[model samples]
Target: MHWFLAVERRLTRTALELAIIAMALVVALTFYQVVTRFVLGHPSAWSEVAARSAMIWMVFLGLAAAFRMGSMIAVDLLVDLSPPAMRRIVHMIVGVASLVFLAILIWYGTAMALRVRSQNLAGMSITIAWVYAALPAGSALALFGVIARMMEVWREPAGAHDDELKNVEGSV
Candidate 1:
């Protein structure tokens, strides 16, 4: 469990760093597009496509961090209301559900990415598969993160769980 969390923490940390870079790329590309379109009176088609692609990468890469921090859209009310013993059960159910959902995403997203491998982006020569690949890749990373969080939750002492408010603030 210790080694698993360590790996997961590193994975989530790297994902967050990459996500920040992707976000910066998106901002830079969008700024370039605006400048070329409005200021120079010449629209840049490739920059728009690049910006959109970067945004997608940014969102997907950030997903792992969100899941690791337990900041994903979670209904903690049920777990919070449950008795101490039941809380672990509730968490297990939620964890299993999340793993299942992410697994489905990985399967379908890989299929979709492969299906689009031969296609090109709207204004770029890059294969559309690169854009689609984010789905599966990000989901796999998020899956690991979810598992790590579940481990932490299960290891908590009875009645040691944080309240829903702490969860909302990503304190879990």
Candidate 2:
């Protein structure tokens, strides 16, 4: 279990690093675009496409990174009020559902990417498939993160004490 957690942590860190790089690229590209449009009076032809692609990758990868950190959007107020047993049950159900949903997303996204592989982008000479590959790639990472979290929750014995939950409750 410790080994597994270590690996997951490494993966999360790597994803976060990639997300930061993508954000930097997007900002630099935007600055370049602005400079060309105003100073040179000649906007870059590929700037728009590049920015859009970077934004897509940034958003998707950032979402996965956030999910790994347990920072994704959630309505856990009710869960906070529930007993620990109930909270554990709810967490397990949610984890299973998330895994199933991600599996379906991977299947569909891969299929769509394959279908578009032979297609070309309108303005750029790049393959349309590359643009569409983000879906499955993000889904795959999210799926792994969810499974890791689920395993953590499941491996706990019933009635196990959660130190974090106790701290939150001031029950220490």
Candidate 3:
């Protein structure tokens, strides 16, 4: 169990680092686009598309990081008010539901990405499938995050405040 958690933590950290890099690329590309279009009066056609693609990757990868950190929005008041026994059940149900939803995203997103693998982005040589791949990749990461959270919940005692506090801190 400890080894599994360590792996998950490492994976999440890697995703986060990649997302940060993507975000930086997006910012740089966008700045370049603006400067070239306005200041230089010669816009690079590929810059906007490249920035948009990077933004998409950044958003998707960031989603998994947020999910793993318990930063996703949720109405937890009901769970908090429930009895300790019921709270565990509710948490399990929520985790299962999230897994199911992410699984669907992974399935359909991968299919769509493959379907469009031959298509290239306008004004760029890159394949559109690479951008689309972020959908399934992010969903798979989120699925792992959900499973890890469920395992943590099962391992901890009911009514444990650590996870709750972390969630609360993340929200704020």
- Which candidate wins on TM-score? 1
Estimate every model's Cα lDDT from 0 to 1: 0.83, 0.70, 0.80
Clashing pairs in 1: none
Q: Give a tens-digit lDDT track for model 1, residues 65-130.
A: 887766644546776578878877787788899899999989999999999999999988999999
Distance (Å) between predicted and true CA of 154, model 1?
1.1
13-58 in candidate 3: lDDT tens per residue? 7777889999999999999999999999999989999999999899
Count of clashes, each model: 0, 0, 0
Q: Which rank order by TM-score, best down to worst?
A: 1, 3, 2
Tell me the lDDT of model 3 at 93: 84
Q: Each candidate's root-mean-square deviation in Å?
A: 2.6, 4.4, 2.7
lDDT of 2 by residue, 24-43 (tens): 99999999989999999998
Model 2 alpha-carbon miss at residue 116, Å = 1.5
lDDT (Cα) of model 2: 0.70
Q: How does each model score on TM-score?
A: 0.89, 0.82, 0.89
Superior by lDDT: candidate 1 or candidate 3: 1
What stretches of model 3 exceed 4 Å from their correct place?
75-78, 81-84, 161-172
